[model samples]
Target: MKHFAYISLCLALCLLFAGCTRTRISSFRVETPEAPEVEGVHAYMEPHSATYRFSGSVTISPKETMAVSGSYVNYSSDSLMQQSRSFSANGYYEFGGSDVNASFDWFGKASVMLIGFGVGYDDGIYHHLKVGFNTSVVEAGVYLGLYHQYTTLEINGSTCDTWPCSERDNWGSMSETNTDFYTNLFYGLYASIIIDDFFMSYNLSIYNPSVSGGGESVSSPDIYSHYIKGGYRISKHWEVNAGLIMSFVDPDYRHFAANVGAAFYL
Candidate 1:
């Protein structure tokens, strides 16, 4: 009986060792959980949205390289018209806008280049001072800001030589219409809509003179026409912009321009 007890104890020890070995082998054979596949598409397209941010963007566009169409005609207060049909190279300097702010909100855009310098009836320096707030067409807000402009046109020899009046008569009145530097205080309703890579904005601004100086000084008008602009984001911080600017006077003025520039946010 004692011998049988010893044999039984040995069999129990063997069974315990076999069970532990089987458990160890089961753990080792388990395959590592497959690693998740990361996607790059979402990463590339995310920056284009309103939520996508930019630090700043800067671009330099020279007008000398662009072919200018149309001519500039200078008219005297004395009822004389002179025309110059020469190609002009003009400079455009604009800073700060809704898009500029939006760009930096995500990343950033910075540009340091000569915008354009043209020899048209254009003001040597045409500036746009706009204060606006906007959301998706789904959201709209009102903003008020000053739109100031300093424009100078050198009397073209071809146009000025044919003046109907003497040099003195031409000089006095010609100076009035040739160069204009005025600032308009405008409060307006602005709205924007974003579709794909394009964005469009409409602003109906009431133009009033905040600082009336230089040029033909006249009391501000009661009302002015509305302006509309549309732009497309070509790259991270680069955009192609175009717009129509108009005003009412004895003779209404309408200007259409297309330009490429960089927008920067603060």
Candidate 2:
């Protein structure tokens, strides 16, 4: 099938560019390996259901991570489905982390469809603040943020995914943990372009974390993360995407993942 071939080509390209660096088909992360992160644009350029919208997506990185994210948007009072100006709140809760990882973002866009522009804040591990501009076909942005890495102690327990926990609960556990935190700074740039029903995006980020002990602080080696993705819209309310994600922290600490995802608009 054409879709199968497309995915195969993507994987081959990822392997080719990964080079001789130690590569694992796993989630990419800056700090905790257990907390694999997948980042990308979660919305489409046009064909929104209304001025006020809700959207959700699910992404899976083969042998790596799976995540679910959602967004809510409020368009400018005078606008309709095609957002000329809007504000949005987004968030995700993911599995495949040490335990689990959850984060949120707030974003605003202006002058969309023509020369679009936006600013946002992310409470994720990297790139907490972002600003970007877009045209009808192209988009670009940069982001910077601070993260705290921590060593955690967990004992005698499990994790929960819902409120009002019950005995017959899935992924339920009794656990307690404490963390010792260190500081990290991250900055990144991303670009995306859309043509017809096809779109592609790329993100690159650098992370630097520091540890303090014995009255002295030492900085760790910088880590670089990359996410490249391409997708096609199948219908007005549905789309499918596939991409490659990678991170480098020297030759011995390289990580890669290939992901596929779908988004729905409402």
Candidate 3:
């Protein structure tokens, strides 16, 4: 749609004038470690069409990261288009980490989808809390919480999506698994701003994980991640979004990704 194009153009202009280095970093060697998931801002700006919502997304960081995630939500009331207080319960799952991560959330809001807040827990990994204010054209918020970190290693075999690949002569299967050696607790901060359908967010985490169990003690660097996203509501029941995610692992490593997603209301 025309609105989507305008949003996309705005994002492009922002990136172009950001004044960061233009060096082309190879995506294959970048590692995200315990990167956080992308948060949705459009969900806070408007009412849903129905009491149930389902959403899914795919993200690719060239050769570095590939992931899929899904979520479901159930509202307590039948009609949610009016300005009233309500409650909802939701579940989310993702297959991008060393192992799968899942969580359940309970949300309470006092607005016609214009201003809201929620608190939830993340399956022993994260404690979630967020609050936001929204108007017809702008939305802003902050999310901060605690999370547990794990020491993990991932290995992958040679693989290609198409047959008879020109990139390599040999075709092999790919498998990824991780072993957790220790765990540490860290604090995370997330801040976001949205204008119309375009949004931007930043995440920060800084902590040192002391060695526990059998792994040798090592110092870890701080993590910084951010993204710019744009979405369009095609109908009351459907919305589509696309964005870029960039995560820096401090010191010398970073991960860059592009994602596309859709949400359905029913």
TM-score of each model, paired residue for residue: 0.33, 0.48, 0.47
Could you tell me the lDDT of residue 146 within candidate 3? Answer: 54
TM-score of 2: 0.48
Q: List residue ranges in candidate 3 displaced over 4 A.
A: 1-34, 38-40, 43-53, 64-107, 111-127, 145-151, 154-178, 181-217
Q: Between the candidate structures 2 and 3, which one is better when assessed by TM-score?
A: 2
Which tens-of-lDDT digit does each residue in 1-266 have in candidate 3? Answer: 66456545644664677621111111111123434442434544344321334555666644443331212221111222212222121111112322233333333344643222222222225554555554455555555555554444333234332311333434454433454533334444444555544455555543333221111111334445565567776776676877776666544556666767776655
- By lDDT rank, best first, the candidates go 2, 3, 1
Q: What is the full ranking by TM-score, best candidate first?
A: 2, 3, 1
Q: Please give the clash total of every predicted structure, in order.
A: 26, 4, 0
Model 1 agreement with the true structure over 1-266: per-residue lDDT tens digits: 65446545644664656521100000000011101010000111222233222222222222221111122222222322233122221211122112211122222111211111111111111222222232233222343444433433232121222223333442322211234554444455545566655766555545433211121122322234344556666765455545543333214322222323334322
The whole-model lDDT of each prediction reads 0.29, 0.45, 0.42
Best by lDDT: 2
Clashing pairs in 2: 157-174, 157-175, 158-173, 158-174
**Model 2, span 1-266: residue lDDT tens:** 66456545644664677621111111111223322232334444443222222223333343432221222222112212233222221111122222223433444555552121222222234326666655567777777666655643222223333322233545433433345564566677877887877888888877653422212222335657677888887877676777776766556556565556565544
